[model samples]
Target: MLQRSFYERPVIQVARELIGCYLVREIDGETLVGKIVETEAYAGPLDRAAHSYSNRPTERTKAMFQEAGHAYIYEMHTHALLNVVTGRVGQPHGVLIRAVEPIAGLEVMKQNRATVKRQIDWTNGPGKLTKAFHITKALYAHPLNERPLYIEEGEKGVKIARSPRVGIANSGRAADYPWRFFERGNPYVSTFRK
Candidate 1:
């Protein structure tokens, strides 16, 4: 399990460093694991693309104001996206886990995403990844170091690439910020790879 301090740093740093980390989900004795392949950083109120932009705190975004390392799950359209809260209290910074490569419990993931015909498609995007791992809004504000969901250290020395975040075309100048980070040449990265 990663220590709380691991997520206490700046959101951008945490987002970039999360590449290659293992996202583990232990449910009903089945331990599902995946290697984080892509992430996007959302800085505090200053970042227009962030849900907490302008210091706005709605009931849905309440988890973002919690201590670092907490889950900040939120709904987008019909899907739930997972974010790791970062920065200090009242500073609503987070790192969105964009994609992951299956590392364990492949059969379970396949079962969870049975509609996905291709193996790579199972966790190639944020919503799809969360579905495969059974992550939901119920996990909001849950600590990342706890059971059912946690991040563990994975392979080191991974080369990373950065680019503007995906699906934020209306964020004005913030839309072009290079906050997205992904493992170089990782096929499991989202389709928006740059």
Candidate 2:
């Protein structure tokens, strides 16, 4: 598989490229893989919904500046979510990997997920994906070029649909931007309808 070009484009572009990529994680000598199916692009300092809006460079958001193709993991209300830092070094922008469809090590995912049905629960949310994959703060700023954290081309990428992202009612017009992309009818997608 071709390694993604970290400097190819902005967060929106990167977000589109990210669809159908495989997010690989290694836990306890076992490898878990999931196909990227959903994503949301948060672009520029003017993007009010972005973590680094207005170029606010706090500790939690500093990862947004460490070039693209790096993991930006953060906690939200005691839940860990993952984002891919994108754009150039000085540009504070990223694409939040909202959800994924587990493809490998599903038994591990089931064990991590407990009894939440075989579908609709494996990796449909940011926090859920982390829980299912055993991802945490330890993976923060982890280089995607290394093992246990790299993304690869999935088995025949799917066509992505663009729509406004879920939640973010405080971002004004930015919240309405159709930057979210997802596979059609994929059970692992964040939501079925736009």
Candidate 3:
């Protein structure tokens, strides 16, 4: 298991490498584990799609400037989604964890989900994974290589594919950067767009 270091590498590399890792979240005496299968990269300052582009920092985006491998969690509507801020200090870039394949604590995930019709449906989306894992603002900027909430290395023998980011209709050329990575034909992938 390759435990991630907060300063191990650049955001792009981290984004590329994260495709096969596992995201584990422990909460309320239960552990929810998932195999990471999808990610999207956001580069620093110059990347228009990045939150820290142009170095314009805000309270919400402040955590993104933290060292690499730190979780940058935030709320989207009523859902909290988890992201990993990449790049070194003073550089605000990140990779959004788009989806994961549930591995452990699935019963907890079934309970967290709105409608767990099947095992795969338990953690098929970013927001759904957050609910299953109990990820929230409390985990914002938390280091990814540390205890309680750390990334665990999983089956590391799959090929990854880079594609244009989903749901960023207005990012212009940045939307076409092919930074989104995912495992081909993974059932846990979030395929819906809205």
The backbone clash count of each candidate, in order, is: 0, 0, 0
| Clash list (residue pairs), candidate 3 | none
* lDDT for each residue of candidate 2 in 18-117, tens digit (9 for 90 to 100): 8888899887888999998899998869798888887967888888888677888999986798988887787888888889988899888899889677
Candidate 2 has an lDDT of: 0.83
Regions of candidate 3 where Cα sits further than 4 Å from its true position: 1-7, 192-194
lDDT of 3: 0.80
The order of the candidates by TM-score, greatest first, is 1, 2, 3
- Model 3 Cα lDDT, one tens digit per residue, 1-194: 34446445777788888888888877888877888999888887877887778796789898887767788888888888888877677788888998899888977887878566777766677787788787889988888877578787677777888788778767678877888888888988778452
For every candidate in turn, the CA RMSD to the true structure comes to 1.1, 1.8, 1.9
**Ordered list by lDDT, greatest first:** 1, 2, 3
lDDT, candidate 3, at 87: 67
lDDT by residue for model 1 over 122-156, one digit each (tens)? Answer: 99999999999999988889999999899998889
Give each model's whole-structure lDDT. 0.94, 0.83, 0.80
Candidate 2 residue-wise lDDT at 41: 90
Candidate 3 global TM-score:
0.91
Better of 2 and 3 by TM-score: 2
Candidate 1 deviant stretches above 4 angstroms: none
